[model samples]
Target: MQDLVNLKVISLFHSENLVRIPELSSATKLELINLAYCRKLLELPSSLQHLEKLTHLNLRWCKNLRFLPSLYKATSLTTLILSDCSNLFSFPEVSPNVRELQLEGTAIEEIPSSVESLCQLISLSMEDCARLKNLPTSICNLRSLEVLSLNYSPNITTFPEMSRNITELNLQATAIEEVPSSIECLSNLCVLNLARCRRLKSVSTSIHKLKSLRGFYLRDCSRLEIFPEILDTLERLRNLDLSGTALKELPSSMENLIGLRQLRLENCESLVCLPESFHKLKSLWFLYVYGCKNLVIWPDNLFSAIGGASLTGRVEMQKDLHGLSSLKELDLSGTNLENLPTTIKQLTRLQKLILWKCERLKSLPELPPSLIHLDAHDCTSLAEVSSITKLFEQALLCKDKPYTPKTLACLFTNCFLLDQKVVASPGTPKLQMLFGHMFTILKDYHQASPQRNMFTTCFPGSEIPEWFDFKSSGSSINIQLPSEWYYNRHSMENFPGFVVSAVVSFQDYFDDAHFHIRCECHLKSCNGDCPNLSCSFTVWSRRGLHGSRLLGSDHLFLLYHNELVRRFVETQASNKCIYKEASFEFYPGVWERNWSQCISCEVKHCGVHLLSAATDDAEVQPPKRYKYVS
Candidate 1:
């Protein structure tokens, strides 16, 4: 042990029965000592302070440790970790050179007053320290400290003034009742978390002085009924979450937060209205206000707020809102009141607008050209939707620039007023090798618009669209691939895809308007093997849960594509294989026997057609199976 003087790293971790650290007064060259998880370690030698070159000391989970030597003599010490040390009640004095000190989940009841004098300290974390009630006020003078976390420290009721350079401050689940007005003096503060501070009733309005502040979280502050106003201070504020709070209204001066990007207010039962200033937050992108049952209508003059001038001392809100030009997403699900203001259409740049379960809504307004994704599901009273044809017009008109397409998924999942036309898809040689199937029928095959990749709506028809490739009149159909489909590279480069068509029997209305259809494709390979690929889809139509048969069959179509099939056929096909057989079966929901709607769906027709006339290079007729045999 005497020759271990030059040891730079000594790890005696998990030494479960280690009772005491050996005298290290002579290990002057040692830099790191890790005794973590040494559950029986009782004490550290006071001579440890003589290890002047020691830089890191870790005693994490050393539950039996009760005291540590004064580390102030270890001038080179930069990191000290004592997390989860249950028996330790006090921290040793650390050197001013220490940069990070962690006592998270420790039983330490008080911090050394010397902490404020550690000029080089950058981060001090003592989270989950239940007994810790207050921090030394001198710590506020540590100008170099950037992070101070006291989250889950229930006993901490008051926080002292903090350094202006602190970028993050976490005090979640604490007993703090209020923050001092001096908090605004922290101009560089970027993130402040006060979530679940139940007793926190008020905050200093001077918070606006934090010009660099970007994120503020106050979720679940049940008693915080009134929030202080920030006249015009935070220009860089971007994300603010006030979810589950007791807030009834937001201060009227939020318009000046021009850099605001997202605001979350979900489950705020008492919130009744949004400030007119919300409309002028031109840079705001995402706004979530779900489950705010009391919010019914958005003011017609959302761009104009009352006492607008008095709300801010200097920054005047623009008198106009030509749509939130930079806004991309907005959620207002689960509300009560009816129609949306006509001004909603002014959100010209909006990409998604979610309004699920708005039971009182009856009609949709004129949609914005930039609008793509929309969700209004479960609106039982909703009877009318604007013309679906115009939905794709704007997307088609703008194809020269980058655009985010509105999600085509479940766009009208439960809207019974809309009808739909169905299309079936066929597999190509490439598709046979790539994956199993491509729902080409559902993909926007005809639309040249880049933003409208898929279309979903309720249409009035049981017949397949006349534009389908192959036409048939049966519940099942078999089709062969064109000869030498894989030989020509142009087959995939120029070919759009095969179009399959089928008529669904919707004459009988089920208890639930939603239907599940599983399409299975069985391939009989030339190598005497058959493989099946199957997929399922959930589709909703105008068919009522309980309605008259007068509605007849609701025709449906979907686009299908798969990657595994294309790769398998191209490289795994048998040598003698010139032609292969493909068959498809459709089943409704969980019942395997009910492949078709009604007792038996009269197959209006089942057929496949090659998407392009590349027959000049490869014929559609089947070739001899033995053509390539030895």
Candidate 2:
């Protein structure tokens, strides 16, 4: 120890066995000491007080540390961290020059008034200090303090007056009942979070005075029945979350928030409607109001005003729905609407439309051409989906032109009415036409480009179409390919790959069950050489309580993969090698639990079909198994 007189730094990071640090009496020039994650460290050497050059002292995660020596005399210290010292019960007096002090997860009961002596402190965090009760009012005298966090301090029943220079303040899950009007004095404050403060009932209207405030969160404050009206424009405020609150309505003055971009009001059951001027927020792009059961009506002119806004609620259809030209996603789950306005087809850029539990919707209108995903999982009253036939017809009409391929995925998991009406009809002509149109689109899309796009659908059915040339009773199947089968002498399209089909039967209802069909493909050449080219893709996934209720019955899953399969087979073809046999093994299961659980499923049957553009008249053949010969 005597030979370390010139030592300037000491770091014992993660030394879990270190019980204590040697005295630093002789190392007067020591400038920094780090003992982070030294869980067995109980205390610092008292000789540490004599080091005049010590500028940084980090003791983070020292769980057994129960006390810290007074650092008031260490005038040169600028940073001190005692975070996660679970056994420490008192705040240590730090030097006036200290710029940052962290005491998060400590057992400290109260902050000493002498904390005001830290005039140069820039940040003070005491988050998750369960035993902490009150902060010294004298802390407001810290003129240089900018950030203060006291989140999860349940005993903090009153909002502490803070320094005027404060920029960010977090008091989430505290017991504060109201934000006093004096809060406006924090002129430079940019962020204020009071989320989950169940006792919070009111906020001073003076909050509008925070000219630089960018985000304000009051989520899950169940007792907050009203929000003060904004009298002036707050152009910099971008995000405001009031989800899980009890507010019945918003003040019309919200139109003054011209720069707001995201607003979340999820599960606010008491909220009946949005303000009439809600459309004035042109910059708002994402709006979520899911599970607001009483929110049955939308403002009449709301859609026409916000040109590109995304919203979800029980919409009261208006004559014109095309005003939202730039909207991309819309979720109207759990609504009572019976039908969508025909103008929905005018939303040329709409991509995803979610209607998970709209039980009263009896039919679907023709959707936009840009539609990619349509989720109507449990629409019990839906009996007509003729619009799908029109979509296929449109694709057929444009088969000759060069265009980008648009993939589509539709989920009709438990539409019992639709299944009885369409799949159970006398000859099932509609069902057959739907499958035929889908095939035409797949062929047309493959001819355009090799870009990977998938088309998948899920519906109630028990049998595979007879067109599939290869069929198996279980989950595995093998197919034989003729030499030079990929090359066609007729048209320009190289090869139109194959389609896979599976029948899955569920045993019992599973909450949040995500069904997936994985296929492992292996290829073998005529020379006995085998290349393991394995690939798997998710064929079907479903969630939500309503969607899983009726999933106990059998359902059919279909997938079309042209480009994906081509990339694999063509790799071997380029080597002047031909794969005479291809084998596939299917595994179907739910992601939520193991196969032995009460919620289980089995793949009852599997089949495959190959597509070719060489001939216009193709006939369905009998099932045949292919084997590789050495």
User: What lDDT does the true structure give each of the candidates?
Assistant: 0.64, 0.74
Q: Given candidate 1, what's the lDDT at residue 208?
A: 85
Query: Who wins the lDDT comparison?
Result: 2
lDDT per residue, candidate 2, 1-630, as tens digits? 576679998999999999998778899899999999999998888888788899999999999999898788888899989999999998987779999989999999999888888899999999999999978899999999999999999999999999889999999999999999999999999999999999999999999999999999999999999989999999999889998899999999998888887787877888877777776776665566655666655655543211111245434554345244555676666656677767678777677787777777788888877777888877888777868756644433433334344466777777766555345457664444466556556555444444555567777767665456667767778888656654323322434367888787876756466666776776677777765655455544565533456467877778765556656655644355555777777777556554322236777878777665443433322223422221
How far in Å is the alpha carbon of 244 misplaced in model 2? 0.8
The predictions' CA RMSDs to the true structure, in order, are 10.8, 5.5
- Residues 462-535 of candidate 1 have per-residue lDDT tens digits of 54443344445555666665554432332232223333434565544442444555556666755556656565
Model 1: residue 544 alpha-carbon error in angstroms: 30
